[model samples]
Target: MSLEKIKTVTLADVSINNKGEYGIGASAVDYSDELYTYLRITDINDDGTLNKNDLKSVDDVDAKNYLLNENDVVFARTGNSTGKAYYYDKMDGELVYAGFLIKFSLDSSKINPKFMKYYVLSKDYKGWVNSMCTGSTRPNINAKMYGNMELILPPREQQDFLVNILGEIDNKIEINKMINKNLEKTLITIFNSWFINFENYDNSKGMKIDDSYGEIPVDWSVEMLEDYVDFVTGVEPGSKNYHEKPEPNDIPFLRVGDLGSRDNGVFIDPSLSKNKILKYDDIVLSLDATIGIVKMGLEGAYSTGMRKLVIKNDNINQPFLYCLVKSNRIQRIIETFATGTTILHAGKSIKHMNFVLSDKKTMDDFGKIGNPIISIILTNLKEIEYLTNLRDTLLPKLMSGEIDVSEVNCDLELKYNYMKYLFNQIHTPMSKSVV
Candidate 1:
């Protein structure tokens, strides 16, 4: 690593224009297969990745004018999301960025534009954003201001090397993410048939009964959710205690928005928390705004907006509880409990909710089948978090030329093999066919 190899340049120096182009001022229509996907500021995650769960489309005739290309990087210019970005990936399909975003098309001849995307995710660049936007009520970075933002970049050859390495890590993360997505979907389906609907197993066809919830196997009964599970709300260790970098004794502070990934952009001292520390594959649900987002990952302290469903009774079956929390019936009920204007908060609605329990043998059998699938999903999630942390750790060092990754083997086939081996490690015979 050499200081001479690094150069200082304004964002505009590597971009097409001094001021980046504004996006379409159009509302999101219901998703249209024929129309371009409408990307709002809300669509960009804290890590500079696009949120794919609620993808909508723009039906405007001028939607094509706002279309993003592979070379373009869009920035969120206003409010709490100021400086947030989303790099257009073709895999996301053709996208039309909203007006709140500023599109910066890289001048490929100057430097690799993708470098800036990773740079934005770096602590240095984020620090600059904080410095620039300090003391603003409604923080906003207009297009010209974004263009004026400076970048300290590595030499062109070094830029390419860093890009390839970082890109490989990201691609691997995406692969693991997709694997977990499919795994969760499969697990939920299996849970529904085996426990919820009682349709898949031989014992499922046994005597049935219609009750408060619905029709269920005769041996299955509904119990108050609170009776079997201790609903533990998370601890909030003050904003002053929150730090971005992971130091000793610090764990990720899982917020409502952080249910998707382990990296919530901040960490807090776990010792500060008197509440229950999360375990791997723990059933957790968002009890606040954007309610009912159930996910299992991250052994960390969580925010007040979340609830960890700790099973006090061993007979309840953890996997069954997981599937029950993820089910549509539970989701709808949780949503109904949420109340607020901008930020909805769910009360102790678990008291009002019912947990359907099957016969001990049936519950045990379902756990046997479902636990492995949950384990696979959890494995992939942990891997995704591991890879993401690896990439994030390497990003700043690589960008600042403190470390050189030029000799790294980042070839496509090698990356593919590495990902294959990771997936191959924990996969069961059932997981093989389910996937």
Candidate 2:
């Protein structure tokens, strides 16, 4: 199939109402406790999904015009992310897009929105858009420029087939995301019940008591955090000492800022030497600007600036420990311990901190419950990594007509089911809550 056969379409062709003149004006409004779903550049993840935490609501009508629905594919038509796109899904109420965001609907017949979304998110498309973008002080791409941009479209059936295959992968990715979210929440809830609220008996061991919150669970005891784990501050390798280039197979060096919520851990950049490595299963805690953010290093070298918490006991499950540290309860403790002006700094002496510890049986039970979920999470992560690599491999080949899409099987149901099972395990007795 010739590349030209898949006609070049544009945002104008697929959208119903291409109202270019509509602009969200700057209007000031009071910030309220009731959060209105607002979309910002930061909300758009590199993977093309919107992060709900990026929501911000203002008590202004003008701010409300940018409201979006579940299927709405918002285009970042201006600023640094001029051509970036995001598909809003599982969002509730009225969602207003930022001034920089341009709203558009997908023509399902001519183009699959997901496929179009993937196209727009492609490196080649982004590079082209970036090159075409105008504006001196602040880079911006107008609606006209967006409409003028071309896209390669296949037959409706083929488009659907491709979208369905990719969509299955995406659905599983989303499911895994939800599982991780619930796992995180569950861990947080457990932490809150055990540590923060100090649920359970007898606090006579030189510690204060507070039972005002709620009922206490039996077999739980409160103790200082120093008794459980040892905290070690990371040493900073000066910028000059860091190497910018290394072999492709070199160990990944993770930075404090590179910690992403998606993986529940930090990804190592494979440009660092093996000599500067942190041991496997070591808890990587972000202590600098973003304190209390925890992730486990999976067999690689990492920066010394990001604090590493080494689990003192062999029996203590490192994964569970990592999850506990990243829990909101622990975050609150770290916040309270933090002391600094501009940047919130978690104190080096986290040893004095206190927590409620459960019996070994309970800890083991909790670990067991978390084990499968963690396994599923890790599997989904590995699958995502695989899909990413596969997609990257196939993209150029498919685009260049080196490998025919006709030859590839698009039966995604099998893969989808496997992924869904992993998701369903964690989301059993599922709540309507969007995680």
Candidate 3:
């Protein structure tokens, strides 16, 4: 690959306002919920998508000038995350891009937008961007600096071919995501009907029953959470003795952040022994900063941080219990129990707090419904992981002309059709009576 053949494209040439200043001034208007979504630096995902949760709304006219459109790529032009980019594909209305971000669009005639997105996210580009970043305290990149960076430009046809191949894989990943979302909605619906709304049986008159907690359904019984399970806190191994090579190869260790955004959970650096490991189907809950965010460990050994509550599943269906702990009511209970002055934190003794526990039959029934949804969620997650790996593996190879696309005849169109069929088939009603 000849570095000389690759053309240097500047960020300014492709941006809506190439000469715009780095940060928005104080005159920038406040955002409103009823109006446009405001995109901040935090809203940009590492993988080139917008994080909807971080979006706010702004009504200012000056801020609206930096508004994003479909196909616009917003880059974190300033701050510690400089050069991180997001390709905006969807927006309800006009969105204001925070001053910390640089907004640009690809010249589609010369470059494939999707290809350019992945290229910027590649290690080579990020390394270059990192090196070019200037500032002693808060590093930042200007449009001029970004525009001078060179990139490999495969012919338009080859660019399209590569983009199409990777795009197909991404399409499958989205399909899997949608499937997982539908599965979650189904589980949530079931939970709300059975527990929250009490739609499982007739309750037209808002009936009540007596139990340990006092008022409850006559058919339902309450038991303390401590009666069914024991909660254990996580211990940090400390950064001093943390070894990367030898330890990570053996036992899996988890951190508070390892609980993935969409998936079940992730392992941190692993240790040597597998014996002192957190196994599959164990319920792990966050106990600090952001409390009570619960997830089940699907694989690997994990660290039991002081902020983590490791629930020992003693015949209680782990999935069902996880759902219960993640419920709105339980979250309220956790919020009330949390203690702090500035940032409220979940207390260390939250595990000792007692809550009404449903009977074994009820828990098991809920488990039956939940387990399938969990299985589907995990399966879709694994599939996305696999697709991501495949795409990453092929990206550089295809771009560098090492792997010729002509030689490979994988039927991406057929795969996409099959993916759509599978997605629709998964949530189909089992019977007409059920619907």
Candidate 4:
């Protein structure tokens, strides 16, 4: 397969619909319990994947004209995400994209939608976007410009081979994510059972005490959250001073928004300010918009909307503390403390909130059981990050024919071993004792 032998064609040529067939989607409506899934520009992740958890919903009657079909590719046609694209695979429920998106109806026989989707997300597409998009305040690209953009089409067989290889890698990534999600749920469930309900440790079938809050574990005492942990909120430099493109020695700027995913964070210049920076395994909680959102991944200076909690006593156990803070009960308590329409968490309220403190020895024992599970979750997270990076690196190369699949070992086992080795060598060590 020679590069010269491949056919290059404008996107207009591979589309089944006429030149102006691409359609702008309907405006998104508020989510309804029984409605079609609504996709907006922001719902398409920067990596060309869908943000499944954050989807909105609209009535079927309103979305009928914009209902999505398999093999349809949608593009973000305006603003900062102007070039971002998502490939719409078939779904069990009806899905209608929002107004900011433009849908491309492709003729799959001439161009593989999956392959085209990847190309649209590649660095090359970004370069083209930078050149073609025009605006004073925000970038914008129209359907005509999109139609004029060219794509390199190899033989149909080659396109299938590339798509198969990339699709399998993506499937593996999704499987890892599901595994991690399950692990997290299991861990939280066990924690809730043991500590909150006191169901797993002992029945205490006969012993009961009525406290200010509720039923009691006779051995456990309630204390203020400040008594158990010391915390610090981050500082946000104004947009003028913040650097979007980080240089050497830059630290990742952790924000409340970044808590949505394990690896979706951006780097920032570390020299700018005196904000509290966090390390891997550090307990950080979101304090704005969505109160009590918790995360412990990535090392960097956190944003004002987040606070890093340090266990005051060494025996309290950080992993157990993380579970306690992230628990549904505590999160609800935090929500009660939340004031203002913008979802602000009052530090004074947090300082005074009652917290159940387990006996030090009991918490230490719980840590012994829970830390290993947390470690496994972290390990899986590291593996997911590795796989994501590998897939992203390969997507462009494979699509552009810079690397032939034939020259690469696409065997799943071999790839796993290589990634495992890479993960083991580079992974940050989990803390042995509470931080």
- For TM-score, the strongest prediction is 1
Write candidate 4's Cα lDDT for 229-253 as tens digits.
8778887865665555565767667
lDDT, candidate 1, at 283: 80
The better-scoring model by lDDT among 2 and 4 is 4
Q: Model 1, which residues run further than 4 Å from truth? A: 17-19, 201-209, 240-252, 260-271, 405-435
- For candidate 1, write residues 1-435 as lDDT tens digits: 678878899988888865599998988988878878899987887878778778899988898988899789998899988888887888878889999999999888998878987988998888988987899999989988989899998888778877877788888888987888787778788888877667854665576656676666666777888888888888878889888766775666777767653233577776877855677767888888778887776577778888888889777787888888878887777877777889988765676688677778878887888788878888887677666656666677678876664655677556444544443453311110001
Residues forming the 10-long window of minimal summed lDDT in candidate 3? 426-435
The lDDT, on a scale of 0 to 1, for candidate 2 is 0.58
Candidate RMSDs in Å, in order, are 5.7, 7.1, 7.2, 4.7
How many clashes in candidate 2?
Answer: 1
Choose 1 or 4, whichever is better by lDDT.
1
What TM-score would each prediction reach against the true structure?
A: 0.87, 0.74, 0.79, 0.82
Ranking by lDDT: 1, 4, 3, 2
Give residue 53's lDDT in candidate 2 (0 to 100). 55
